[model samples]
Target chain A: MTKTITLLLHRGPYESEYADLAVNFALKAREKGYNVNLWLYGDGVWTPHVKNEKDYPNVGEHLRKALKDGVNVKICSRCAEARDVVKDDIIEGIPMVGLFDFTDWLDNSDKVLTFMR
Target chain B: MKTLIEIFRNTPPGNACLILTKNVLSVVYGESFDDKIDEKMDITTKDFEVQLHPFPSKIAEENGIEGAPSIYINRKLKIYGVISPEEIKGLIEKAKPVKIGIIITKTPNANEDVENILAIGEEALKVGNQVELFLISDGVWVGKRGNTLTEKRLLNLINDGCKVKASRMHLKACGLNKEKLVDGVTISDEPYEDLVDLVMEQWGKVVIF
Candidate 1:
């Protein structure tokens, strides 16, 4: 069975180290042959709001690196709804899921890392 | 005993602070009954003692508060931001674990990440679990000896048998060495290996800050 790592992020881009570090960890875990699940909760749902950036760092773009490498990503629907985050507000192809979805990921994960404030 | 709930909010008041405060009150005590009276003064359940800790407050500073609307339950359990009533209930009812691995990745005093980390470690110890910590990035600064609040908490955790390891690379990057660190903080060369092993094999849960 392929080992899976669940990275639960609770912070958004430029807000703290979690967003940037979560992306970096996700990509590295993928490269190391681990299945990575990026679960965005709280302010983490806002990470996908930013697009391309020339001068500043856009974690979404860096997150794309992990996504392109088959890293699974999900955002909490409750958090999204509370923050008024619609499907269009986030990167395409990622699903907004319920908090219960995290329970399933937790059970399926070999390791769960919560990246919080 | 009234359940003491400490709510932390940093400099520059946040909407979440107010919202969380509102939600917590409403959760414990339903919305105001009197329609003519706008402000809800009714207390359905008066078991909770809520303390709002705005930034720069003496008690908050003494508590090593890291605000982003952080909440501490009875000065023990902590959760970031607001949570559902069900979730808060679950946190209170949570059980013990065999091992807990905590990673602190930020420099201390810049914020209260150290407080959160140390508190968790101490609680894990109190619960009779093996607690281990890895300090990476600028977080290695926490290993340095100091007379500050953060250091006191770290020392308490260490004295309580919580194992702490500092990243050698980060310690060097910050121009620090074994002599500069506190007595109990371990500065090992191959902590990444230990961290990986602990996260993958030993720890049932890993909380990174």
Candidate 2:
């Protein structure tokens, strides 16, 4: 049976390699026939707003690819607000949700991969 | 100073005992506590068939019983002083075989942490306990086929009966072939979530490395 996985991203894009690695894992999980859910919280909410700059792996572009590959992405609403990431400033497909939904996803998911700074 | 959990888990089930009341309560509340234990045991002891041996306080003291309501599971001392019925039941359940699930996400070069976890799993397997490993993230990088010392360690763990797996997506993303994984690693067709569920449902402990 297809198993569900939640990739919990808790780090920002710039300071560490956590966002790049987590996105890579999420993409890989999707390619492997797993239902992948990406929940952005804490500093991770900054990932969706990251612009592809010179000399760096474009985290936003990779997240877009993950979204295109059918990965379900959600951003923690409070975290997004705390980081000043309004709706239009974020990626198009990823929705802003609450921690309760994240908790619910945690309970129902078969696996959770956490990336922290 | 060992807690009941430590004593019960450290010793095998049938070979363990627990002594309660190594304090002034042994004199003041011993009789009442024993009576309560007897009453509770009548209804609750059916599942485990654990026998309770009661002796005169004099004989108990002779055996170095420092407390009241001493409990012996298989003949070894498991605890000392003050326990509830619910706690005893929990300890009994803990006496069974320990099931462990380990997830390795860091790379092999990341402080050699993967080797440590593999060693732990191997040790558990050597003692006839159950241990499983799931590799994800950069952890999948270790699945590459090679004769390196770390790879050999991983292969040794598999030879010792450890169930090793890697995330399918990680494998594909890293361009690793399932057929080429070091002699016994499986790239699960199911999602990473399922692997987590399988571990949590089947194992008694889950540790992420």
Candidate 3:
């Protein structure tokens, strides 16, 4: 049976390396056929901002790909408000929820992973 | 059944007892030791099914062991439990292994510090050791994506199968975005007290950075 893995992300883009790693892990896990859920909490919610940079790989793009591949990408509503992130400002396909939802996902999951910066 | 009876007689009815005597001094002795003495005492008194005995000084006593902060099972001291000389070895081997808890806090020197801690964790993993790593306080900053050495090292460690955790409350306090963190990191809703209890229960050794 496939295992459900929950990833609690707590970092932001251009601040440290966590965003990149989270994307990579999601991609790899999807490739391996595991059910992966990526939860954006705290500062990690800002990761989906569409970057205008020329050289860097887009975090939002990575998330979109994961979503296309069946990964559940979510952001914390409380975190977004605390960080001044508006609903419309979020990337496509990702929903803003609360800690309770994250907890529920975790309780129903087989494994939980954390990525912090 | 005979072996079980012998074990029951030698062991004090619970899990093996572990003594971590690390660099702690009795004041009167004017000396320091590097083991988990209090932890050992607690385990000895607890109502668990199996026992884990920790002997931190069997090395300095030169009984021919090489690591400090080491564990001695059945009078045999080893660095990472590598030596045994008798049939009792099998019994000692049957004892439950210790869990290790590692916490990395973000600081002004967050980048380099997380990298170093991850390197240490990788080494532990190489030895077939399992550990739980928690990122709390400013340490949550290490979870940020892009332009940091610590981030890269942390991702590598996660890929290599390290259990990574972070404090959810701390992240909110710092206004850090959970989406920006690396994949495979779990946010802990449990309080710091719970974290401490869990670590104490699982790990024989707890290292903080």
List interface RMSDs for the candidates, in order. 2.8, 5.2, 11.5
Q: How well is each residue in A1-117 modelled by candidate 2, as lDDT tens digits?
A: 777778888989867667886787788778767788999989999888865555756999999999999999999999888878998887788889889989988898886767763
* Model 3 docking grade: incorrect
DockQ for candidate 1? 0.24
lDDT of 3 by residue, B1-209 (tens): 11110011113322221222211112101233233344333232121222233233333344443433344343322333212223333434554344567777655263466667777787776544666787876777777666366677777878877878877877787786668778878888753544534543455666666
Candidate-wise lDDT, in order? 0.75, 0.67, 0.60
Error in Å for residue B201 of model 2: 4.7
Q: Which ranges of candidate 3 are over 4 A from the true structure?
A: A51-53, B1-209
Worst 10 residues of 1 chain B by lDDT: B35-44
Clash total of candidate 3: 62
Which residue pairs of candidate 1 clash? none
lDDT of 1 at B198: 67
What DockQ does predicted model 2 obtain?
0.12
Better candidate by lDDT, 1 or 2: 1
DockQ of all models, two decimals each: 0.24, 0.12, 0.02
Backbone clash pairs in model 1 (N, Cα, C under 3 Å; residues 3+ apart or in different chains), count: 0
Give the residue spans of candidate 1 off by over 4 A.
A55-58, A81-89, B1-97, B106-116, B119-129, B150-162, B167-179, B183-197
> What 10-residue stretch in candidate 2 chain B is worst by lDDT?
B1-10
